[model samples]
Target: MHNESIRYLIVPGWQGSADDHWQTHWQKSLPNSVRVEQADWLKPRREDWVGELQRVIAADSSPVILIAHSLGCVTVAHWAQLAPLDTLRQVRGALLVAPADVERANCPPALRNFAPVPEHLLPFPSQVVSSDNDSAVSALRAMEMARNWGAEIGILSGAGHINVKSGHQRWEQGFAYLYRLQGRIEQSARRRA
Candidate 1:
């Protein structure tokens, strides 16, 4: 199956990805891709974020694939934990990158509501990409989160946060990961058929 057959949702983290961020780049570069717009990016509320994500997913009829970064990954997890079976069935897969450890001591106060990250395994296929030296999240914790979410982990050596500031502008490798996710979605569809 081609990427055009899938609906890609771009979920940005924290203050949201800047114009040069990879998430934004992919949103622009890919067809049938839309960003899950949050009302407030600076002061994130877990419920609000998850609501918006669910709203977007509910509005789209096509098979959904999420490309989430940092806190956005947490939003996906929270939604997956609470979403209805129909909503869960619509989600084909997710590419979770640089999930912020919101439980960390130094985590910003605004993000504390997202703490106690949902431990339930995602109902759909997913892959997690983490950096070895992410300032917001430790590598060990990233791996642990991947295990908890039942997602395959991809460790990038010394890549800080895997954001634009980390020198990952137009990250081709990340695109490759999304492509792999599409393949997994296709395989799953084939099995179901």
Candidate 2:
């Protein structure tokens, strides 16, 4: 499938991605892509974040591929668990990167509400990308989460959170994963047809 044929929904983590962040860069570079903007980035409320994501997915008629980082990944899990069947069907797949371990000891106070991360398997195809050196989430924990979510896991050696600070701006590898997911989705659609 052509990259332009699929719609991409960029979901940024807590405090949101900086201007130079890869998510931001992808939104700028990719056509038919939009960020699921939260009302409050600094102090995010789980329900509010999930609600906004639901709204965005509901508003769009095209199939969506979610690109979520950190807390946004958690939001996707919660949204998947709570969304209506029709809303969930709109999502083709998800690329979950650096999912913050909200249950960890030093988790931020603002993110505590998202603790005990949703354990149910996601309804659609998904991939989890984790960095071996990510401070927000340990690689082992990320692997565990991937297993629980029924997602394919990709571990990046020494990449810290895979963010702009870690020099991942315009990350081609991540885009490759997105393309692979698009291929899988298209293949599945063909099978169903």
Candidate 3:
């Protein structure tokens, strides 16, 4: 199937992306991109997040690419561990950005339950982008998680939190990376053929 036919699901972290967030903009720009709406954003129940993702994936027969930020990245990782291998095979790729340490997010006690999510490599190709000055996870720790997940690392220079507060309005570089990932996905499909 054509890449355009694939479903691009955007998973926002705690508090969910704002109206002007980059993810929201991406969803508007990309034809197939849609947000993975969770039942509760503040309380952040891991099982609920995973269940919603599974439901979304089940609803769409097209390939899926997950774009996750903050705690959402952790949700993706946690889901990967439980999702059937067959369901996982349909995932084309993932873009993990500013993943929360959970162990160090100074998160509320409710969210604290999900800590130090398993550091296992994902079966599908993925990219982990981190900021040099993220308050949530140190650059070193983010790199460590990237290595653990076997994902390519993209370091943002002097960026903090990589959020709206970091002055990241028009993230051209991120779009460039996504374009490159599209090439990688096409190459993988060719290999399968």
Q: Which candidate, 2 or 3, has the higher TM-score?
A: 2
Clash pairs for candidate 2:
none
Error of 2 at 40 (Å): 0.6
Where is model 1 more than 4 Å wrong at Cα? 1-3
TM-score of each: 0.96, 0.96, 0.94
Off by over 4 Å in 2: 3-5
- Tell me the lDDT of candidate 1: 0.91
Residues 1-193 of candidate 2: C-alpha lDDT, one tens digit per residue: 4756678899999999888899999999888998998889999999999999999999978888999999999999999999999989989999999999999888889999988899899999899999999989999999999999999999999999899889998887788888787787888788999
Q: Evaluate residue 189 in candidate 1 and report its C-alpha lDDT on the 0 to 100 scale.
A: 80
124-188: candidate 3 lDDT, tens digit per residue:
88888998888878888889988998888888888877777887755667887676667778888
Candidate 1 C-alpha lDDT tens digits along 62-176? 8888999999999999999999888888899999999999999999899999989989899888999998999989999999999999998999998999998899879988877
- Candidate 3: pairs in clash: none
lDDT of 1 at 181: 73
